[model samples]
Target: MLGLTQSQEKGSDDTIDDLPQWRRVIPVALGLCLAFALALLFVLANRAADDREDALGNQRRSYEVIAIARNLEGTVARAESLLARYVVSVDAKDGQRYSDQWRLAGTLIENLRRSSRDDPDKLRYIGLLRDSYAARGKTLNDIALRTTYDQRLGALGRLYEANRTRDADRIQRILTVIIGHEMKRLNERSTLLDRSTMRADRLAGSYGLVGVVLLVAALVALWVANSAFTERRYARRLADSEARRVDHLELAVQNRTRELEVANGRLRTEMEERAQAEESLRQLHKMEAVGQLTGGIAHDFNNMLAVVIGGLELARRRISGRGDTGGATTNVGTSGVGTGGKSEHGRDTDDAVRHIDNAMEGANRAASLTRRLLAFARAEPLLPAEVDANQMIQGMSELIDRTIGDQIHIVMEPGAEDWRLWADRHQLENALLNLCVNARDAMDGKGTITLSSGQVTLRPGEINDCPGGDYVRLSVRDTGHGMTPDVLSRVFEPFFTTKPVGKGTGLGLSQVFGYIGSCGGEIRILSKPEQGTEVQIFLPRSQRSGEREASRLLTEAAMAPAAPRRSVFVVEDDPRVLAATVAALEELGHHSVSCDHPAQAADLLAQYPGTDIILTDVQMPEMTGPEMIAQMRARGIALPVLFVTGFAGDDAEAGLLDNEHVLRKPFTLAQLDRKIAEASSAPARGHKEAAA
Candidate 1:
């Protein structure tokens, strides 16, 4: 009996083995196809439903419009009827009714006019009704306003005589035309609504039939697959029965052992993956929270700095704001020197200026630290312009050379290769030099740091984390030990560093990332363990401003030589800064008006209207300096505005270093004066149409 069962099972196994591999996947394929068909059917049904709803809505609106038109006609007729009665009986009651009906008619006509637009012809009808209502309203007012019975009757008879003379006929004819036109629109919408309903029904029926057919076919496929599965199960059971009397215990033992091993491996893999994902998620959340907190404090801290610096400036001015009338320049080299030579008082004031300057320098450095912190926090705004990459790099060569020290060899690519990139010049230079310094440190200040530039065009998807464009590439490569993959991965993370503690802030790479990202640029790190590291920055190439010749004519106006600009309107909410600015202006041989508020500056501008330059703080109680300038422009005051703020805000108020109107806090008298010069020379005040 055992041999016979084995033979039968062997035959069944052979038959199952002969089936094609594709046969096993047939049910899944059919199910997927049917799911797609059902999905398409749902979309069709949704579209049909939307169309039906829209048609029905239009029909309802048409009905409402038709009803309103009829009501308007009734009100007009009622007014006309009451007027005729008042004319016949000369009664005050009739006159009142006439007045009320006329008012109601006018209201109804306006309501209809507002709601009547279904087509151009419907609009025309509403306009006609409005015109007729106007004519009728005039006549009705004449009749209703007469206080005496005799006067009321006389007005009504006059209206009646006018009605006989074709005016009333013209008005009624208009009403008739409008009502008929609305009714026509109503019928059209009703017909469309019915047609849409019929089309939707037909479509539903068609899709329903197709869906049923697909479902039937899918069910037949499922049944066939189930039959095959059942046959295979039976064959396995037959084989198991044959083996039961032989080595069944051993087979069960091995099968259980293999199953346990697979389950253990899968569980371990899932646990490790889950742990990694959770850790990454936690770190990301922590960074985001820290960034938000830092960004919020930065703005408020800048405001405090403005107050601090503004006070120091004012105090310095009070102590040392003496005039050198005899062309003896101040120690700061600012113009307007007093005639007196170096006296004991002058020496004390000069010492005071030095002390103040030292304080200002330290404050300005603190401000710079705050700015870097902001950049690391990704809160700084970039004001990008068409910048010549060669010019920018060349300008920074000396600073880069000084900062990296004598141990490092700095090599610039020979010749001035002209390529323009749209970038915030200051931020880009900072990021570039930062990368160079980082490379210098990597080389232990002993290797060559090659600075080079070139242009390349990239197609879409070539560079990761960047939009593809023709880019001006700036590269800083060093002959230093490169980073391993593990270290390189965290290179741009804030506060993540490979250096020993107290040696690095870990914000250098982060700031580079932030500034470049803000300018729509991308950073590339090519490094491996032990090999030299190379960092490439890619900034999108931009067209030169205006024509090439015109761009060549363009100069950094703020840096050019100019005379002392006078007639200054100083706007600062901080009293110290206000006083400092006023004194500074006067000390520089310029006339100035002090405003404790930005609104006061606006008032001053309005009152004088001939102010040369507006020196203002960015943040104040009533309004920001930018707001003051905007308000002044709105009032047709086209005066020059120089926005001085302690800290940067959003992109709108963030000042470019080259912006003449924007000065940072803790600035020297010379810096303040230079800004005034730049503002006075700016052509923004050329808008001659002043605000009234």
Candidate 2:
């Protein structure tokens, strides 16, 4: 097939070069000239049609104005006739009909006034018409409310004499004068409109004649062009068919050429695939290395935080407990032992407690930063609730003010009624505080922070890049120095900041962005250099229930009466945290058996079978807290156990971390007491059910 096609293509090509080129040029040139003439003629015809349409439009407007003027005159005459008829007959029906006519007249007059508002002369006459109508209406109202004809029969002659000089008669005379003046002006306008319309008709006819002449000339030129092309066609028909056969042969040759190219392309593609596979392997190895580094660093860092935080709490207790008589060191923030406990040793206890409190504050802040890092790493889980954003803002009002200090002003704006938001309340507060603090720094501690919450609707291709639906929009606008485009672009990038070292972790806004995204919300920032910045976050509206009921139960349990003191078995791998837990439980008026390992705690659990609760660490060397409890339960130990962990556990770990029994790490003494109370009560209910 290839050999036959090549032979035919060569034969056709050898015979085609003999045709004359002049055969094609003459028709193409004539056709172009013909097209230009026809296009010109089309343009001229359209222009004439447009002119005729515009003239007709003007004529129609003139007719509308004349019709309105005549209607105005008729409305006035109708009202006058009805008014006179009612006065003569003194019939209630006639008077009501007259009132209706008066209202219709007022409407017609107002229509005229609006149409002619730009005309000074027409405006003056419309004003006169309104005044005359009002005066006549008042006089007629007085007459309508007056006595009947029979009651006024004795004074009928005197009333008739007085009615001649009344305001109604004067108003009637003025209306007649106004109507006459308007009719004259309307006639003059109609005359001028007729003249303009006639002139427009003449101009349209002239334009149409010129257009027809152009059309005929363009047709003649096109006929000439067609004749010239036909004459040239006679000279080229035989050669054109021969050239077309040659083109077909050339097209077949191209098909075989493309087939040859395909085999080469396939070879190149295989080589490219091999290269891509090698690159992918490298990328996989890099990701594995990064994951190992990140996980190891996080685990080691959290263990160190636990040690530091636990040691501070223990040392502060011992120093203050020795001189902590009368609970002088019990004041968490304001326990100036110098002010109240004036003993020498009491002052030392106060200093120790204050220093530890500051250290604890720093540790807590570091813990918060760690939480953000975990969140960004997708290792943390959120405890979202059906929270009313407005109420949340109000709850944090005082805390925000104090955090921002007295140099700045704070404003709280509530959302609309009944709008519900779904988010973690504590994380949302932290994000808000971070924004406020950033705002304060931008203003150099001397500006205002505006916090607002409201329900907003977003549409596809509208405000806030989100799916079209209802959303809760919370905004933090600051009257402080803003950021440039470059800074704004990277504001939500982890570890990117413009703040000086030691001043910012640079994870504040990034955490906010990640957390909002995790909750199916979007955060947007608007900023300009030297101007202020506005951060707006939009969360999807929720109709979730059962959340509030669960929250209420937790609150009630936390604040309700303390549970009875009983033995607590504690298991922890960290000795410091384990010691702190035992001391906290003992301080809260309970006996505690503490163990540094799960094996020891299990032995203690076996010996002391009368224990009320077991508080255990989540990640232990011998066994995790959940694993140990499962072992005990396998042996038929049905006591309620609380699993405490510093890490943000996953969904499978949720059964152990039921907000009531599972205490998070770095919890205070008060938190321990509350958890114990709640945990003790949960088991007591189960025992009562068993007895029943």
Candidate 3:
């Protein structure tokens, strides 16, 4: 029995040794399975993260492209505004600004080209945008070049007549289309981002659940194994590593979500700003329309004033018994009374003269008012000449005293003797008179008005909208209740007035502003409540002198040695004006042939082959005076022509009328006689053709 028990114990020892080897194999297999599952989960998480990152990158690119397009649109708008301002102000700085903005827009287009390379449709649109921008840029460049070469009138006409649909409007439409496309892309990207995030979340959840199931199965296997403590320790370390990886992935996704939110916020802000900008553009367009309307009204008003003034002057001459008998073909008598200033109807001569004088004064005032309107409209016919400001101020001292009243003290502060300005002397005088009148009113006709002048060297950026150069500065200051900031800001605006109704025309400062700008000058006003006001005008300094002498000589030549009586052919559209013109020519001791239409001028000239001078109105129905002249030239009729106009604003026909003598409307008989003499001395149109 003892021997049998010993053999059984040895067999039991062998079985125990085999059980340990099997135990080691079971734990190693479980570890391998756990590692494989972790590896698969890692790969799935990494793929989800990469897909989300790609979606985010695409969204960012869409935002960048859209922003760039909007910026490019704004740049184009700024460039156009600068070009328009240059046309009006003729300021070189504005032109330079336009060029700079245009270049920036080009750079933006290049950026767009780069941004849209991945999208075939966007690339095609980009190409179209670039081509359109290049064409538009070429047009603008031509305009700027013409303006630079002093072809301002032609440049302005071309600019105003530019085909918006083909150029600017087309560009805008393309930009809108581009923006809309990008907006669609943005929406798609947003949807993609949401889907990517959701997919990542689902992938993470499914993988996590699989990992947990694998972990639980490994734990259950470990619990049954003989090496349970070692297996459990290994499994715990792996679970900890997996937990850290999941936390890191969740943090990364949250960060991406915040980034997308930030980009969306920025887009919203840009959209609001663009809305405000569009509103401002609309306001500017409205103001431009008002300016055009004002100019048109002023032009028509000037023509009517011309007729009224001419009729009144002719009536006064007839009543004064100064009418001549050389060409009394009109219904009105052209015969002078015998040494007695009496009418043919036996009316009281002195009373008629006084009433006529009062009427003449009223008409003259109306003429002055019309001139102010013309100046404000920037359509005033400027006759620029070199002027000595000191001399002019001195000459106007007596007139200024009488106009401003004795109660108001006038202080003249003249600059250096060599300081001179190249401007229209008459317009300059009108500007000064307007300033003085404004000052007198501001001070209630009792304060000191200082008229000062000096030379100044201006640097770039020192003055607003003015170039760097040597300038002659004229300042008109008044000691009175000064303007508020609100009023001062709007003082240069046309038709804006602070005075009571009928007390001021509201065009004084605006006319002065236009005149200064037209003369290549700038005006600045400084004032504060109760601190008095100072109006400073800076005009370009003249490089030449002896202008006064030249002007006086020309005036004398026009007035001296009036041409002998000859047949004058007059073309007028208004019958009343035609009758007055014929009567005036008769009174000037010159025979007249009158036609009421420009179309009839050629026929009239045909009948009257001995016509010495052709005097025609510039703006006529059916055909313009210049057009009529061109037709006559085409027919080989090279008669010397004289243009009579109320407002010489036909800059398109400026080339045709450049060499032709022009006489402004509401002209006196002496002015008429002088113009006739000047026209008679001019070479025929054939001479101009030959010279050309």
Candidate 4:
């Protein structure tokens, strides 16, 4: 899931199957060309426009200077017209005023001549004309200067008139020269205009070319837009196809998920069935081992019993016959009866009897030990009940503390009154005691053991490495020499032990494990060497009321015989146990036949049809006891078979005990009697099918 999130953020696509190679290059090339061409065109047009603007400005300035010269001449002529006509001729009558006027007119005419003198013809004519006018002006001025009589006045007047006429002729010559020059200049200007018109035509041609390029660019832009639209259409199709592929992929994934779910469900069912079959096999194997061990123990006990019975009978008969040994009573006091407690010889007899009684007591203890071993192996049914776990701890506290000796202190941390658990009371107690003993041994009986109980609610997905459920937890904590990591790692392994020889039976913890597992509970251990150790047992809550009621019935049954003895056919591959079971059944007042295999018993059943029940060892090398029974039932033999098993590999013996008539290894004569009676009291129940 995290990987999926990261992949989404990175925009990774799994589906890009068909992409065109050419689609990538066209747009990139087109964009670069367009940009470069546009930049180059802008630079060229800007330079051309700047050059044209400069040329036009220079031509306008030249025209403006010419116009300024023409305007100055007109201004002077207007002023001359006003001065000559106005003022009532006051300045005309005065020589000085007249001289000033003539000087102004001469300067004005000189300026006009010079301004128009750029043309070669105009310069020569204007110069000649100016010289003629100067001479005329001099003549007139001389006449005006004359101081004579009337004749002289008349002469002076004639000269003035002649000079005036000459000046007029010169002025006309100057006007003609100026006008010709103006006309020649106008022709030159027309030539310049013709050149400008040619340049304008060339400019118009270039502008038309620019307009054509602009039209081409517009057309290219339209084509590019159309190409882009086509490309967009192609891209849209690709996107749509990719989207459809994704949808198909999603649908396929959903189908695969459904298939996977169905597979998982089938696997779960198979696993449950496998577990039940495995457990049954384990129980059967345990029962077979028990049968062998029980036969051996029983055989040995029976031999001892034979010696005792024979010796007691011989002694009784000898006493009844009144046989006296020589001086056997000589140690009796002289008063005919011993008064000093007893004579030395008499004390010896009493001592022999005590030894015999002690031997019998040891035998009884061995039988009791056998019963417990069988119970742990699951040969017997569990009696479950609602129990205050804290109270149970309190009840067992003294015994557990005593077992560890005074070196270790045992503490009971009782939970509040609300703490309750449902389980087999005896089995639970045994499990707790086993843990306490294990803790005590780990501590070498010198530390403290605390037994505590509590209830816990588990949330979903929180397993504590155990299956999730409402559980009552009973924990045993010890301040003993704890287990190292290496030791702890394999602590739960069957037959694993660290204790010195004869100090421990490795079955202690294995039994606890099996019992808890069988009850749908779990056990966990935590330990660190030199620090401490704690073992927690978690049992799921039970809601069934029958377990509680059944518990009471079991307790009462344990007190007395709940079954009656009947004829039994005991089948075993081991000679010792077969003989022992036969002997034990005989002692228990039942008719019994002993065989080394269920096959042998099968033959007997065919021949006699008188065997009331079959008691068989489960794990035989040739054929398992359950398999033998299955074979027998197939053959129409209807006798019920009770299995006898040992605690070894009890997990493999569960199937044999499913018949509810198995006796565990090293059982007392009483347990064998009970099982045989249970088998004979009812018609044989059919074999249970393996759980599906």
Candidate 3: 10-residue stretch with minimal lDDT = 222-231
- When summed lDDT is taken over every stretch of 10 residues in candidate 1, the lowest stretch is 551-560
Model 1, residue 662: distance off in Å is: 3.1
Q: Write the per-residue lDDT of candidate 1 for residues 265-365, one digit (tens) a residue.
A: 75466446434333433454466578667766775666566556655666675565335322553454233456555666667767877888898777776
Q: Please list the Cα RMSD from the true structure of every candidate, rounded to 1 decimal place.
A: 32.7, 35.5, 10.6, 52.5
Compute each candidate's TM-score over C-alphas. Answer: 0.43, 0.42, 0.55, 0.37
Against the true structure, candidate 2 reaches a TM-score of 0.42
> Roughly what TM-score does model 4 have, to 2 decimal places?
0.37
lDDT of 4 at 459: 67
lDDT of 2 by residue, 1-692 (tens): 99989988977776555546775676667657656754554454344334434433443333344445455544554554544445434567876776787787778777767766656875786687688678766655555555244332222232343345555455445545555655566566546545544544444344444445445656765454444334334323533453364466456545644643664475356445433333333343454455445545555566667667766766776665532322344433334455654666556667878999999998877665565445434344466768888888887778788788998998889874588888877667777877888888888999888899998988874755668888898999898889989888888754466876446655578778877888888888888987899999898898665756664676576645444677988888877676667766665667888878776666677888788888888878857777777677665677777767766455466455445366666666656766776677664323443344
Full ranking by TM-score: 3, 1, 2, 4
Assess the local accuracy of residue 517 in candidate 4 as a C-alpha lDDT between 0 and 100: 88
lDDT of 4 by residue, 334-422 (tens): 23354657666566655655665566466555544444444444443464557777788887776576666888887888763555666
Give the clashing pairs for model 2.
none
Error of 1 at 423 (Å): 2.7
C-alpha lDDT values of all predictions = 0.67, 0.64, 0.74, 0.58
lDDT of 3 at 275: 40
Candidate number achieving the greatest lDDT relative to the actual structure:
3
Output candidate 2 Cα RMSD: 35.5
